[model samples]
Target: MSSETTAASMSTTTASQNPADPVLAGLKTQEAHPVSKKLRYADIGINLSDPVFRGNYHGKQSHEDDFTHVLRRALEAGCEKLMVTGSDLKQSTYAVQIAKDHPGLCYATVGVHPCSAKQFDSYRGGPSALLSAIGELAKRSKASGHTVAFGEIGLDYDRLFLTPKDQQLKYFEAQLDLAVEIQLPLFLHSRAASEDFERLVSARLPQLPKKGLVHSFTGSVEEMKRIVEMGLDVGVNGCSMKTEENIEVVRQIPLDRLQIETDGPWCEMRPSHASAKFLKDAPPLPKAVKKERFSPGFMVKGRNESATIPHVAYAIAKIKDISVEEVCEATWNNSIKMFGLGEVSK
Candidate 1:
């Protein structure tokens, strides 16, 4: 695929499938939600529906207000720091830009996403090129008031078109080496390749100098244990929160290993069972509705959601069956630990 296509794919995030207007109209005719779902926290994940909602939110609309705009929202939502992850050169560069624009409160990740590798021709041009590109990004990440991690670079069995598995592993291992060289933490993303994923890490575990996280995780209890053992953190996001294992894994994790994310402009979260009132049951404006898809009034919200972080805090508390304060503090600490945002953690 052309770089144009890759860039476009990265940019455009829309609803899954346009529904027929009549279907939506009919659903709306019978629309009467049994209960309202309220959002408690921001469970970050990757998505493609809202452009206005995309990017490292700094709070305002302009890029200049990055820190004040994006960081402020996260801060107000109780997010002390936000790590902006990247997929490939462009997005990674954008991420670094966001971090530089926002400074202290905003951080970044540098690496090629599994999905974007094909544009680079499975890095056929060579790994050296990627390394050099990453090195430049890493330098920018090290600039004043920056918090950086190497991430969104891992194996994804879910995306078959992106790369052959062997090539993906080669590139992933290379990024891991970069993470080791930089002595920075990592932000990992894995999908479907669970069976061999750990062994790949195990081979590298002995040589790796630093730890990292598997963002948007959905692994077995055994997998979770292996990750922790390797000195990595878990990016507890809303995407996997709906399943028994997602929340269940959290229950067993030590508080320090639990980090939270909204993967904003992307992944969606679930609503609190109690706060259904604020949630609209319809989809976007009817005119906004492309097809007759059944547009529910509302979906889940996150920490820095349509409301405040307390909702996410509440959601976390409920999922973990712990006090909101505990989840808040632990996640705060975990994020701090993962991104090297030390002083602000307390």
Candidate 2:
């Protein structure tokens, strides 16, 4: 795959390193595969958290500024808008700042991530406290008209930094309860906890939104079918988009039920020599990523190539074997619908 930044450039080498350096992670799926079949949906979820690899901060350095930059790039790439996910209280507030600043261009999902849920005394206290935490977030989301759903809210069995599974479970269920009470769609995340994730989701299946998505989904067709049956639009992004397993899954997923994303400033999509065209649409924005001399969302410069959003879109278009406009329009549409953009989808 083609990437603007090399692998070495993405992982932090030292604590003294610049925090603004754009760290790239990488992939896409969900709205559909055939270019003509992509329904132009919007990306309902995006990671605005600053990555803390080996304890060094390196995701979205300053939420407002970075978000503004990413928002512009997303819009330029043809996304009508997005629903942002915050990392924690501070980050969530910063996300709200972004939402308040750009009412139509951005939306937000409020919840402490599974990884960060431990730090919150409220989350640590119990479901009631978690609800209170969510309540505070809910108020802000309402105030900004951007709390599209409850999200970045799920289990991360893999990253058990300090929080235990039971604690994560409590935190997760608590957030899920909030979604049920508020009657909002959910922006979910699950890493190495699929079976547990399924049990949790299944228990609450009846209470969730008619439509939502499992962000950065990686699962077998059966698992996908289960979630799809529950009415969630599977979010297929760049990282998973290039894989054969992911591709095969994409080939199986019904077109209209799918969606796409960059998960930008993270999940950086690498362009393949074979599938160069599928990597367009993610414009490389590196105000902070300059230290590594790399851009996350797009492939690095050189070989007479520019890693712009349109370029990623082009790459996606070619990979799906569909027209560029179709890919753009459908994913854009999908985003709007997923985020409950309603009349604001324009």
Candidate 3:
């Protein structure tokens, strides 16, 4: 696989840390990736609360200013709303704060990431205590009109080093139960544990909220079908288009059941995936988009940003032989339906 495709893998690491990652190195010098202008979209999952995206860059020291910069860029590119994801308690708190501060521009998810599930066992009062705390945060976020879902939570056997399977299950079920109890939609993750993931989700399907999403999905066609059959939406991003096989998987997903996201600073689409030759009727790159950096280190030339979601629409349109408008409209409506974005204003 190309370095760009590999760099799109979901992780908390920056491209600079991985010397071999060309995508990161290219960001410093590469031309900005093309994006469609006036494409109103919503990112189902983005970690705006992550420090790396907020840290000092371009002589800026204030994280709030850094966030505003990113959000403004996204607004200029047509990102209507951003769901800031929280994988653990600390990050969840940050997510809620960002959403609360921004109002309609941002929303927060409350739950522990599967990889960080070990924190439940290690913390005082164990899993129950963590759930209670997350519940409280969810309450506050909801009261502030910010919290939209319960997640970044699910099974991740692929990262066994981060949390054992047993502990992951314990935490996953607890959060699933909590989500159902609170009557909130879910923002879930699953990797290398499809069987258990399906089983667990199937077992809880009835109690869970009426709508939910499988964020950053990179699963088999069979798994995708199962998820759709269970009445859940599937999220697609740069990672979802890593290989031709992955592209084929995305092509099969019903547009209505699919939602698009940048999962920014990660999951960037490979250049080859959305080259000028393939982008039919795509508009010229915006001057500000080209001038902006996706993060403190990665320029718009390389790193993924919520603003670049149009590229995701472009790539999917190419693979599915559909128009970018169709992809954008369907995903936009799916996000609104699944997250009930309309209710936030009330």
Candidate 4:
């Protein structure tokens, strides 16, 4: 059969399962949600452009079409806006392209991740040259479409597996400077480099823009406090809620300063953590997702997707001693203000 014919067959087979089936029920709940009642959600950081997520990791699945399906599922789960992150020049360009294609629904950030910092020296002209190129791309994206933030940049000491500490710092500071120069909000990442990350962000606070979010924050309460004190927002995801200690740190996050993301196909919430407690009481995975094996982790049996964001909200509600609606409203509003999604809202 032709590729198109095969794809149609698979989609039909996945969709034809009985809705009463346990695995198919959750998808029905998500789909049956009222259109008017569909609360809007903004995923502040998700690598939708990542090849692994687009289905490259799996055999023969068309990731391009899968992104469309993912977006539809996300909408049903209340996520209408997504910020696609770019960890390097090529990825940044791809992110911008995706944002352009999706318009308001998808936005992008353009910057080099600290993990990729070593590549800076090898660029055509080197560090200064790459920075200049990034600046140009940021300008072009801002002028053309939905490029809301300037990052994916910061230090990651946990696995300097590729870039050295010194190089990561060098590139991180350069991107921070670029964010300030461009006057855009920042999407940052920092792991195991809290001391230096805190010091660096603190030093730059005076001139940096008011909107900055530390994505996937898996740090201590003290570190969370410091980040909040510096006027930066905290992004919480499956990664942030991985441990009971992390959950406690999550509890410390003021509602106004907290944002939720899936960081999907990566940070699937483990059952042992607090954030996933709702799953015990929640509906089953959608049958189509199971058939496709979209979720990650053997325990969860699926990779994390934006559609699972409601679980994150449920977890936050349990932790913060507030209603799920309250958590959702706050995070949605936080995302709007932080990412400037509200400016273009209809």
What lDDT does model 3 reach?
Answer: 0.74
Which regions of candidate 1 fall more than 4 Å away from where they truly are?
1-72, 122-126, 143-147, 206-209, 271-310, 342-346
Worst 10 residues of 4 by lDDT: 9-18
TM-score: the better of candidates 1 and 3: 3
Tens-digit lDDT track of model 4 for 1-346 = 2334323422311112433433323442454455215455688888877654555555565333355566656656677778889899877877787677566667899999999988899999978899999899998998776688898999999888789999999889888888888878888999889889888877776886666999989989999998998899999888888878988998889999999998876787777766676454443443434534444221123556777777777777788777777888889888887777635322
**lDDT, each prediction:** 0.54, 0.57, 0.74, 0.75
Residue-pair clashes per candidate, as listed?
Answer: 41, 63, 0, 4
Best by lDDT: 4
User: What TM-score does prediction 3 earn?
Assistant: 0.81
lDDT of 1 by residue, 79-101 (tens): 44556677787667666655554
TM-score for each model: 0.69, 0.70, 0.81, 0.84
Q: Rank the candidates by lDDT, best first.
A: 4, 3, 2, 1
Can you write out model 3's per-residue Cα lDDT over 57-124, one digit (the tens) per residue? 35453332234446655665667678989899888877776665566667899899999999998889
State, as a TM-score between 0 and 1, how close model 2 is to the true structure: 0.70
